[model samples]
Target: MHIQIQPIDYSIILIYVAFVIGIGFALKRYIKTSADFFLSGRSIPAWVAGLAFLSANLGALELVGMAASGAKYGLATCHFYWVGAIPAMVFLAVFMMPFYYGSKARSVPEYLKMRFDERTRCLNSISFAVMTVFASGISMNALAKLLHQLLGWNYDLSLWICSGVVLIYVLKGGLTSAIYTEVLQFFMIVLGFAPVVWLGLKDMGGWVTLKEVLRNVAQDPAKVGLAHDTALASNAMTSAWQPIFSGSSANLMGVDWFAIIFGLGFVLSFGYWCTNFLVIQRAMSAKDMGAARRTPLIAAVPKMLFPILVILPGMIAIGLSYIGKDNYRLPPVAISESAYPAAVETFQKFAAGRMNATATTAALQTIIKPKLSEAKIAALLAADSQQKLDSSAIRNGLQDAVADNDYDGVILSLVKKYCPSGLLGLALTALLASFMSGMAGNVTAFNTVWTYDLYQAYLAKNKNDAHYMWMGRVVTVVGILLSIACAYVASNYSNAMDIVQLVFGFVNAPLFATFLLGMFWARTTSHGAFFGLLGGTLSSALFHGLTLPAGSTAGIKGGWLATLTVFPSEMAQNFWLAACSFSACLTLTLTITLLTKRDKSDNELTGLVYSLTPKVKEHDLHWLARPAVLGTLLLLACLILNIIFW
Candidate 1:
């Protein structure tokens, strides 16, 4: 925690802030109409959209979470980067983006309204708004927590600092401003983290030392890669240690395979890439359909490389710990309510000498000083053994400090202890930039929905362009305030990411089902879209409520409801949740379609459905088929990984 914040860090951050604000105001020239504000006048270049998409997705959550995963899961956590994301994105570029762009809709709900009816659009818009709010709030909370932890700033102050920066840019330039800022951030953050990771690897004695370290930790001198124990499996706790999904008994729900592949891979991927307003909005701003389609694909290649910068350093950190016990320092101290031993022999000596606040702090520093040194501070680690590794010192020292808690503190400790001063500041700045990108995207999406779908559609149906633009600005400010309040509320929640993703699933999953049916099935009715959405959402919520238990492995399995882990023994939690919700909603959609009087044809819709029914322009349907193919291939690859790990 003894980070020396240099003036250079402050300077860099200040310049970065000014540049962001400047971009926002500069984009004011582009804000000629509602279309321009929301979609960059639909004229953003593909290259810009590509960078923005990457930046939007690579926010603070991914940076911290990937690092945490590296500390916990070793090389296998990179699956999220490669197996999960790359193919999904390629799918988005080739298949989904065209559908969205060809539809020529301003927003996803607007597209839905064109595809279904007014009722469906309204329902989707509200759900999307709520989801965006929850997601943005938690992400903001994450950014604030990291800022406080890294900079010694107050959490509330950090929250405002973050909100202020994002607001200026997004409010000034709209989507155009957000996209350009995102591109700048993409470069700054990636550049900031890359060298730190490279240096950390060097400190660990390079790749040769890294192999030995991993071999030692695995207690297998021959095996060079990450450790795998098929017997260990992918339970909540076990997945933390082993990257492989099927090594343990915890893969009972096929979560090891199915959850990542079908559930996370297919459902979550498409939802974010094609449907989520925050991400798709970047594409929507493209000057034409081609730029929109190519932008995400361009982003995909960089995203594939991002995990290395984000995750590998933490793995190397853990590996470093096993190389030489004396040379390797203990991780951070974890506090718990457990009563401290009244007088440990070692502590008694310090206490007897009357170690007060300054003395106590100094003593702790002395103990940790060796850990900060540049040299390989190896000492006589074992008396009875030739191996210069002291297991007792390392284990006993860390065990007392981190007793009963998980190893989350370890990674943070390493960052504080080893990362250099300027780099530390840069990293913190990068994290802030990353955090703002997410918050900005969320706020932008929320504002767009409020302005177009709700305000234009209902509140001020006949408003002039100037009035609408002003309203958009006002709603954005109000949304920012609401987001801050939500962030404060979210700070009290446990496992904030898990909560965010799950609530997101509960709300957004039904919409996914509705949209998919609406797109593929012509029999899909307005009534179908309405009840399908309702049934899918309610059923998912019920399923989540009834079955999910404490300490679940799947990301979407934790909640306040999970605390009461009492359920019938017949069904796996996720299966019932997914199946019941998907089936119920699907059936409801079909039943409603059959029951309802014929409303209108796809010809009546303004977007992609128009192409289907010859209502809109007939350019090409080939692009729309690509995501389906790539999704299938990605799903297969996921299965193969599962089998290999199993």
Candidate 2:
């Protein structure tokens, strides 16, 4: 498992780190006030902000988790982008950006305060600030773990190195430095992964050969670790739409089309892209409203093609495993005398868990015969037939092996195996770029919310601009330190994506409901907004708690008050969780708005709510320059992709 790091690779990484720091120091002169520090003086261009917008989101979770999901679920994993992301990006550009950009609100929570009340803003600010810090930490932890696993670096050293680089750049130039570096990181990632997909496709004999090999692997029950059945596995791995509507247990994703459409496509997608300040801050920093409106749309072009870089690596890994690639194939070993009983017990437990004991026994024989003595295997099978062992204890032991789902490590494996020393360094640096971009984005967002929303608004009202600017710098340092602590905490969790989605279910899912009501429905009272937000958050917590027993092993354990239900899979549960929370927030907000008084007048609500806002005249602009036109084009592209993949 040890990988030799070449001098060239280390040098490339060092150069990347220095270049990032240089950018930070280069932009330090621009920060004369808190606004300049946090919002880049609201003067970034559409193209720059657009790439940063996408890069801010192209973190360890998107890179590692999406690839892992691709290996596990096949082409269906593209749903994370095609279905769950693009439409939302377009929606934010067309409908939400007008309020987000034109209102001149300092942050997303600040907008909530202007539209709703201080309580609602506070709720959002505190939750968002906390989540960003933790998310930054998660990115740090994932980077450290990857470096340790791939390059033989110490975990703490890796954590310090990565976090330090992010802190220097973000602390020096603040958002401007972060955004510019993010642009650089975006290119780095593209250069790094592009060759990986090319090499992989070349090795696998192109797309057609790869798909045929995958289908052949699917038909073999002995290769069931990659997929279940011939028809289901082949279609799930090759086609997106074919298996989406199948029963829960039929498809690899374990959710039907209903959940994918309403839950993921509509609810969770809009919630994150529209309401999450981590990304919205990027667009808000644009030089003008038109630039802001175009940021997400501009980002969408690369986003549509990202699956080839990220998800395809996993698909390639799975394909490589079938072709006996040294890194992808399982290693050979003979069972030790002491380990024989334990291994046999593991196979027996797997057998007993299934209803068809005869078929299970046959499968177990095929898997274990090479590693175990016939007598030992026979003894275990006889013991299982007689019901003479505790299936739970045996199952627990087997779970230990299953828990090491190193699907996330497939990309790292590809890098070490296929990349030469110089290229290896570049590839590794791309990973470092993704981690730093994720961390910097979160830290920048956290500092702004803490400074403008909480400190300036509540803790120290009427503070001088210089004082707040100083506080912003100080918070930047504090935020990175706190994120390091959170990174350590995150190390205890299993998969990066699962924990992130859990946080989204609790926070983003319901918050979007409040934003949806506030932006469109002027009748939404402050009380309705506040309580509905509270209600949505609680419902998310309740739904998550009820499904804890059925949730991913990666989730936080033992805090659930009760397990009232089970789910087909964690992803399906998460989608439903958002759907339920969104419905709860929408229902509560509407009902409470009807019962409460309208606190803000139409004049006060001008430019904030849709009905109260004046119509924007766009006839003067060229068709391509119009946000509506750009948004429509993006939506059409997404539809075509879905149809082709379908």
Q: Quick one: best TM-score, which candidate? A: 2
lDDT of 2 by residue, 472-536 (tens): 99999999999998888787755554566476558788878899999998899999999998899
TM-score for each candidate, following the candidate numbering: 0.78, 0.87
**Cα lDDT for residue 75, candidate 1:** 56
Output the lDDT of residue 624, model 1: 45
CA shift at 103, candidate 1, in angstroms?
2.1
For model 2 the local lDDT of residue 412 reads 83
Q: After superposition, how far is residue 532 of candidate 1 from its true place, in Å?
A: 1.2
Stretches of model 2 off by over 4 angstroms after superposition: 220-224, 227-233, 330-404, 492-504, 548-565
All candidates' lDDT scores? Answer: 0.65, 0.81
Worst 10 residues of 2 by lDDT: 395-404
